[model samples]
Each structure stands twice: as structure tokens, then as C-alpha cells.
Target: MLDVLKPVTSLKLSTKPRGEGAVFKLHYRATFVFIMGCCILVTATQYIGDPIECLPDKDSIPQKVIDTYCYITSTYTLPKYYNMKVGVEVPHWGLGPEMAEDEKVYHNYYIWVPYMLFIQAISFYVPHWIWKAIQTDKVYTILMGLDNRSLDEAEKKDKENLLVKYLALHLHTHNVWAVKYIVCEILNFVNVLVQISITNAFLGGEFTNYGPKVASFLWQDPEDRTDPMYEVFPRVTKCKFWKYGPSGTVQKHDALCVLALNIINEKIYVILWFWLIILSVISALALLYRVLTMVSPSFRARILRQHGGTLRPSPLDPSARDAVDSLVHRCQYGDWYLLHSLGRSMNNLTFLDVLRALDRELNRSHSSDYDLNEKNLLKGKDVTSV
Candidate 1:
């Protein structure tokens, strides 16, 4: 019997399209925008435009003299590493000889990092784009029909009937859409985790591994730590010359050059790792809450009752209330949440309230129609008796 009546009941409860709002919007899109902006900003600044600065070996007098002599003899230029073109050779302070020509110098700071960020931003947006592409047009069509607020009572009653039908159809037939939306939300969190992992893959091991190192820097007395804990970006530690002094002499000089950009990258990435972790945790909790709400009868009933009381000063009509309750019971958490989220976008109202009002109007319209029909039937009977 329920299987037969379900469609008919839904038809009676059908509603009009609602106003366009935040129903289709998501927070991940905003995050994607922020990340893209960060990438652009870094690129525009030329990775903070910090140069590599190197000096003579101050501790070794002989090396200092050698450096001064070399500087005077050769063309003095800022240390730069072009592939195959040898710059200044940076000597290892404690051990090892100078850097070789075949050894790659690491001056590509602004090159890969910014591009990686741009890619990460795009990755973050993919799931959000997919979700919107799948659901937005359909939701827009559904919500658009509910926007005709100036209808007469008769028309409004008819609209409510239509809404009931739509809701019934959504609950029964379109459940897969709701499930897919929920899966998208889960994927969003998974994407974030994957992004973090990709970053960690570059950063030695765990993203949090840097935590202890950072903490040591934060708390350790500055006097106790003689050397800087972190290295700068575009670290140019050594230089080599393929040809020197017109003799075609091969020369290698071990020098120290540091860029200021590394400090900025370190601080930014540490903050980002923590921020993503928090975001993932929050996303997981929200998904759990939604699942619980959809599956737990007690919770659904409570929300319905609470929402009903808030929607009306007087107690809700029993049958109307039951119908609203059934709506929650039959729908998945994702579907219910979609309605809830849309209602929240409109402040101080719930979707169940919309249903209750529509149901009441529908009842009134039916009663009036029934009363008029009865009067006409009585008039016909009277005429026949005469």
C-alpha cells in the first residue's frame, strides 16, 4: 500500500523552486582560490627577490687571502649557477674538496616551488568542480521553482502539492544523487590528505617531523645555538670554473651563499601543514555527524521536533508533523543536509517549517473545496425532490 501511495503523497507535497543562494557553494572552492592567490603572489615577487650573498672564509687567513687574490684577479660577480657554466666554487668548511663541474648547484628556488603550489591549488579544486558540475544545475532547477512568493492562496496550495511530490520523488528515486554528493565530500577530505602526503614526500618523511626541529628553534636560547638552524633557498654553496685566467685552467672555489627565501618557505609550509591537518579533522567530523544524523532515528526525531517547535508558536498539526518526520526518516543524511544547508542560507528558518506551512495550506484548500462540493450536491437533491 505504501509503495502505491508514495508517489501520490509526494505529488500532493510538491513545492516550487526556491531562490538561488549558497546551496551549491562549498568551502573547498574558497580554499582553492586562496592557494592560487598565494602561488601568484609568490611568483610575482620573484620568490621575495632575495639574492645569494657569499663572503670570504673568515676563519682561515690563507683561504681569505686566496679569496681576495682570486676576487682581484678574476671578474667579481654575484654567485649564480647556470647549468654547465661554472660560477664561484664554494669550499666545504669542515671536510671535502670544492664542488665539481658535473655537480648540480641548487639555484632553482623560484622555479619548481611556485609551479608546485599552482598544481596543488588545481588539485584542491578538482573535486569541488566535479561536485558542482554534477549537482548545481539540477539543484538550481529544483530550488528555482520555489521562489514564487506572490502567488494567491490557491496557487500556493497547488505549488505545495507539487513540492510534496518532488520531495517524495527525490527521496525514492534520486537517492543516488544524494549518496554521490556525500561521497564527494569524503573525497574532498581525501584530496587534502593526499596533498599533505605529497608535500611530506618532498619534506624528508612526515610533515610533522619538522615540528620538533621548529620547536627546538623556538625555545632554544639564541646564545646557545651559534649557527642558524635552517638553510636559505637557492643555496649556492660552491662554484667551479671550466676555464680560468686564459690558460684554460680548471678552478673550483668553495664559497657560502644563502638566499632569504628559504626561511619564508619553511615558515609558510609548516603553517600550511598544520592548517591542512585541522581542515581534514573538521571535515571528517562533519561527515560523521551527517552519517549519524541520517541513520539514527532518535536524533532525526529530535531534530524534527525541535525544528517544528521553532517553526510554529503553536504545536504543529499531528498529520503534518508526521509527514515532515517521515521526510527526514526516508531521506539520506546528504539529502537532509542539503535542505538544512539551504535553509541555513536563509537564516532563522528550517526546511521542515516550509513543509509544515505548505501542508497546512493544502489542508485548508482541500476543506474549502470539499465544503463547496457538498453544498452543490445538496442543492441538486433539493431540486430533484421539488
Candidate 2:
């Protein structure tokens, strides 16, 4: 039984790029793996054993035929009978005689669960795929092997110089790249919301309230308690089949079916509901953080300062503090974002060195421009005087 889940389990264990944050990875990695694992587990249970078995009112009818019929067609339970005493008022909590006007809560979702879960898992991963497709490896490429600590000193300095030069040349060009990642984060949040809506609809609108109802179920008195899992995913349901008798008379056969699959399904859905709620909250916070970082220069500066503080516990000199502030103010959001990412990957001292070198490069370029403008003005005055 455990062997059946190896493939799904492996997906969760596989290493992924560290470019994304934990919440972002949760959508594509943890949540995707979880849903796919459930899909596989349910699918395995479906194929390995009978997911549904029915006892027909007429013993003459073959049990196999009834089970097959009930499994293919949907099953339903009487909501009114769910609270009735078992083996007295009703033979079972949800089992009772058919009525013309009684409302039926159908068990149609069980059979389609595996397929629906597969689709959901894919949906969760689509945003990650879009991010991967649109995002450039510019940050990784520009680091130029500086992230590797094994390089010889001369080679390391060469790489650092190249990185500083590249950053100085392309200071503000990465805003689009940053925006693309932010768009993907927004998509992840939207995907979770859409999945929640779709799952609610797919499960007959029981999913939205599933978590709270299940939580409240534990507090109710034993006699008054009704299993919410049973309500959404009933263990037993009713299925009716019609056939012609031997004498050419119509016969209606009602079979009480035990839906074995719902045992696994209820647990799966409940866990999924809570997981999605948490994911949505975290994703929203991540987006909010992104917005704060984009609009507030102080937040961006604080983050860079914190990153530096983490790498080197020693306080920055006054000049270094000023350099950090200048870099944050001079660079666009995209450039700052790339620098932050670079800080995470590069060696602490090397990252700080890159920052100092890049600052000097920027200052040198500005000074050169000032000198050139001065020389041009002096040449114009000389020409006019002549």
C-alpha cells in the first residue's frame, strides 16, 4: 500500500530552486505534491478494491449488477433521516424509504474525485510554471560564479569586478523582471481562491463551510452530534435502478450502497480545505510585503540593511551606511530586488564587497560625466572668443 505512493512522495522530496520564497514554493511544491498524493491514493483504492458495494431490496437481482449500477449512476442520502435513531426509526442514519418530495444530497463527487484532484494539482502548479517561463536568470547569470566559494582569489576578484561592471551598466533595467515575479505571486493567490470556489462547487457547495463545521462537530453533545464528514461524504447512500420483470412488468429496485471511497475522501477534503486557507493567508501577506517594499523606500532600505546585518554582525561604518542608502535610492525596485536576491546567494563578505565596488563605479561614472561637460563648456568659450 505504501509503495503505491512512492512517486507522489518523491515529488515533495525533490529539490527546487531557492529563487522563490517558502509560501510560493508551498503552492507549486507542497500543495501540488499533497493533492497528487491524494489523487494517487484514491485512485489506488478505487482500482484495488470495490469502492462501492450495494445490497438491493430484491435478493433475486445479482449483487454484482447492482454494485456496478450504483457505482456508475450516482447515490443519494436522505438528510432528514440523518438525525433519526439508527436501527429504529431508520435502518441506518441516512437510509430510508424513497419519497417524491424529500430532498436528496447526492454522492456524485466520489467517483470523479481522483480526476478532479489531478486537475487541481495541475492548477496549483501553473502559476509556478508561468513564473519560470517569464523570469530571467539574470540575477544568477550576473553573479558570474561569485556564489561559489571554491574559486581562487584572482578568479574571484575577476568575477567580482565583472559583476560590479555589469550591475553598474544595467542598473534600472530589471523592473520588468521584478514585475513578472510579482505578477506570478498574484496569480498564485488568485489560483488558490479559484480552486477554493471550484472545489466548493464540485463538492456541492459543502467545502466552504467544511472546516468550521468539522471543528464544531467535536463540541456538540454525543446524541446531538452529526458527523459533518458524513454529511458531505456519506458512508452510505441510496441508488435506484429500473428494469423490466420476466412478465414484462416494470420493476423499481432500490439498493442501499456503502461508499467505501468516501472514507478516504472526507479526510482528504477536510485537510485540503484547511491547507488552502493557510496558503491563501500566507500568499496574501507575501503580496502585501511586496507592495510595501515597492512603495516604501524605507522598507527596501531596511531589508538591505537587515540582510547586511545578518551576513556581518558588525555595524556598518557611517560611509557604508550612506553608500547603502544611496544605492537603494538610486536603483529602481527591480534593481534592488535583484540585489537582495544576490545577497542571499553570494558569500557575505563578497556581497558586501560587490556593493562597495558598484557604488564606487556609479560615482566614477558620474564624476567622469561632470568632467566631460566642464571640458565641453571650456572648449565652447574658447571657440567663441577666437
Q: What TM-score, over all chains together, does every model reach?
A: 0.63, 0.93
Candidate 1 on 242-261: residue-level lDDT in tens? 22434667544455544344
As a whole number from 0 to 100, the lDDT of residue 45 in candidate 2 is 60
Q: Pick the candidate with the highest TM-score.
A: 2
In terms of lDDT, the poorest run of 10 residues in model 1 is: 13-22
Name every residue pair that clashes in candidate 2.
Answer: none
RMSD of each: 14.0, 2.2
Cα lDDT tens digits for candidate 2, 1-386: 77889897665443433356678889998899999989999978635567999999898789999998889888998888988877779887788886899988778889899999999999999988887777756666777777888999999999999999999999899898888888888999999999999999998899999999999998999877888899889888899989999999999988889888888899999999999999999999999999999999988887876684685335646555666788998999999998898887888778888888989999999999999999999999999999
Candidate 2 whole-model C-alpha lDDT, 0 to 1: 0.86
The per-residue C-alpha lDDT of model 2 at residue 117 equals 98
Please report, in order, the local distance difference test score of every candidate based on alpha carbons.
0.52, 0.86
Model 2 poorest 10 in a row by lDDT: 10-19
Which lDDT value does model 2 have at 4? Answer: 86
* RMSD (Cα, Å) of model 1: 14.0
